[model samples]
Structure formats: structure tokens, C-alpha cells
Target: MGGEYELNFSCMLKPYKRVLLKLSGEALMGNLGYGIDPGVVEGIAGEIAEVVALGVQVAVVVGGGNIFRGVKASASGMDRATADYIGMIATVMNSLTLQDSLERNGVQTRVQTAIAMQEVAEPYIRRRAIRHLEKGRVVIFGAGSGNPFFTTDTTAALRAAEIDAEVIFKATKVDGVYDADPQLNPNAKRYQSLTYGHVLAQDLRVMDSTAIALCKENNIPILVFDLTVRGNIRRAVIGESIGTLVGGFCEVS
Candidate 1:
């Protein structure tokens, strides 16, 4: 627990006014074995609050890997589609938890689900979600595109395209995409930037192929960074040199 660091926006290069942040359910687990960790959620909310205060509109898509994974269940002999629906529900749970933490941090938030759960959240509406962001509310998209065989990463890309997000901020356990597993190879090379074609051709595994292809098609930039760092989210938003930037137009410098 440390005090929030004040970002000097004057020194920062903010290339994105609006961003879609993709958070994996496992990111909320902290040091626990499973499920949401309140402290971790709050810390993430705090970082988000900082970015919101900086006038960066943020929309989030949370994955359900911590509670359940659809693919894993399918491997265990469960019906694929049914297990995927269950996984979507798990994402909704994570979204609610994150929304609660963000609200507690005094950040205005809206939770929109792909599957209509009117009692708990607003059904995903692209127009309404954009309106919420324009009004400075952080909108969270849940339920993974309301379909089986798709992922929250795909949801993030789809929503970003729908909402006209300037970039996709993919927060993960690792700092950035590397040529080899950094954990195993200490000398693994981390790319500061990568082309979508390179990622696809090399099979970087930074994101699902479908998700990567979707982003490549839409020409949306993806910034893959470590969520464990307290201020990394804000850093990513402000365009600090922290993570691997993929599939964006680079101006001649």
C-alpha cells in the first residue's frame, strides 16, 4: 500500500483519447488461489480512476479465467457451447465485482452485459455505452460477446470497434510480448513494437488468433502490459513506453 503517484501529463504523450482495456479474471486473483481479491480489484480501480481523472475514456472487457474457462471445461468433456455460456456468466461475476470496486473508489461506472440480466446490469448497447463514456462513466462490458466460441479478448476488440476506441489496452501478468517465455528464458527478447502480420506469422500467442485478427482488421492498436504494476494502466493510457505496441500506424519520428 503506497500513495498514488501523480502523473505529469505534461511530460506524457497521450495518443489515445479513448481506450478499451481488456482484463483477465486471473488478474483479479492477486496472491489467492482463485476468485476475486478485493485488494487487487481496488488497486486496479484506483489506477483506472487516475486515468479517468486524466480525461481518458475507458471501456473494459473482463475475462472469466479465474472462476472458469470454457475451453478447459470442454476439454474435461462438458458440452462446449454450454460450458462457454457458463464461462460468460463467470465474466459477468467478475464485471460486477470490478464495478463495485470502481464505484467505491468514487469512479462512475456502468456494467453492460451481452446476455440480458436487466435486474443486475444494462444489456450491451453500443450507443448507450458510448454515451456513458462521453459522460465520463467507465463502462464495463461483460458476458463475452454473448456467444459461444468467442473470448473476452474478442469482446474487447468488437466493443472497441463499435465504440471507436483508439486503442486496446491488454493488461496481463507479463509486461509485454516476448520472443520466448520470459519466465523460462531470462534472455528472452521483448519487442517494444510489433506488426500484426509478424505476430500472426510467428504465432506470438499474445492473444487468441481470432482476437488478433479482429484487431488487425479494424486497425486498432493493442498495448500489452503487466497489470501487476500499480500504475501501469495509467502509464499505458498516457502512451508511456512501458509495453509492446502492436498494429498501430507509426508516424515518422
Candidate 2:
């Protein structure tokens, strides 16, 4: 809120270049039931600003659970594909809002959607998106891989692999992946680092199995960290040894 306040939170220590940040839809909610909270949006933009200032090229993939969930609606009898399309639109709205917020802070951003929406945003082009990143423009990929039955998590992995991101940073409520849900189980053990095999064997829900498999096959690493804590994004990047690193322990041939 204040100069010193933001200064203290950012630039603590970390220099990063090129990272993928995954934000949940609920992150846009600030002590409220639903919708985008201005304070929450600004706070997150601050987090992005902090890292972008560190000479890092940032890309984001935001979720749509805040407004509506097509999957949940479909369970109530709506067609699954239709429900998913609705969910995809919801993500586009969230992406637009995020783009506006980031640009307000003088952070250059671009919104590329998988679904064709020429009037609103650019269509997803892997080479173009990579160029945007190289040019230091934060690119936000929206529309959930433009396919039904897939999730933003999977889309994040797909994009990360396409862009050659060193690691995918998943910002969650909990700081790191745990053996069990820490909230429900007080004795849950937090894993500082986890292998993809261990996660698959243990059935950890950090990311959907499909997403994990895609990243595993692509040899991309995943870093799960807490976005609730300010500047944690930057901390998790720059190889800070924060959160859980899953898969790709050995480089793929």
C-alpha cells in the first residue's frame, strides 16, 4: 500500500528470467465470496511487478473457478462439453481483467486465447507467444487449452512445454505439496521435493494426472509454492529451493 511496504515485499533477493506462473481463480477474490476484488488484483499485480522488475520474463495462466464452473454445472445435468465451453469463456473474462490490471502497473502484457476471439484477444500461436516472452511482454494464455474435459493445469503444462519454460510455478494456498491435505489433517507431512514417480504412486493431487504426465513426458519441472505469501513467486523462481519440485530430476535424452 505504501512505497516502503511494496519495496519491502519485493526485491528481497532474486533475479529471474523467463518463468511461468499459474494463478487460481480464487486468487482474484479478496476476503469475498466471488468476483474480482480490486485489492486482491492489485496485490497480485504487485507480485508480478516485483518479479518482472527482476529482469524476468513472466507468463501467466489464470483459472475460471471464481465466476462459474462448467464441470460442476455439467454434473447437474448440463452437457459436459457445453459446460466446459462456458468455463472457457469465464477464463477469458478473468484473463482480460488480469491483462488490464497488469498493464495498469506499467507491465506490458498480452492475452492469447486458444479459442478464436479476434476482436478480444489474439489466438494462441506457440511461436508468437515465445516471441512475446523474448520481447519481455508478459503473455497470458487463456481458454483452457481450447478443448473440453481439460483443465487450466494441463494447459499450463502444455504451454510450458511449448515455450520451453524451465519450470512451472504453481501458486497455491499451501506453500508446498504435502502427503495429505494439511488443512484437514494436522499431521500431514510437507514434501520439500517430490519425484513424479512418488507423486504418481502416492496419488498426490497437486496437479491433475494428465497435466503431470504431460510435464513428465516433456521433462519440465514443476514448482508448487504459496501465492498467498507476498513475493513468493519470485522466491520460488531463481532456483530458490522453495516448494516441491516434481518430475524431470534427470534430463530427458
Report, for every candidate in turn, its global Cα lDDT versus the true structure.
0.88, 0.82
Stretches off by above 4 angstroms in model 2 are 1-16, 250-253
Estimate the TM-score of every prediction: 0.93, 0.91
* Per-residue lDDT of candidate 2, residues 99-168 (tens digit): 9989999899999999999999999999999999888889999998999999999999999989988778
Q: Residue 112 deviation, candidate 2, in Å?
A: 0.2
Tens digits of per-residue lDDT for model 1, 29-141: 98888998999999999999999999989999999999999999999999999999999999999999999999998899999999999999999998999999999999999
Highest TM-score model number: 1
Note the residue pairs that clash in candidate 1.
none
Tell how far residue 13 is off in model 2, in angstroms.
Answer: 14
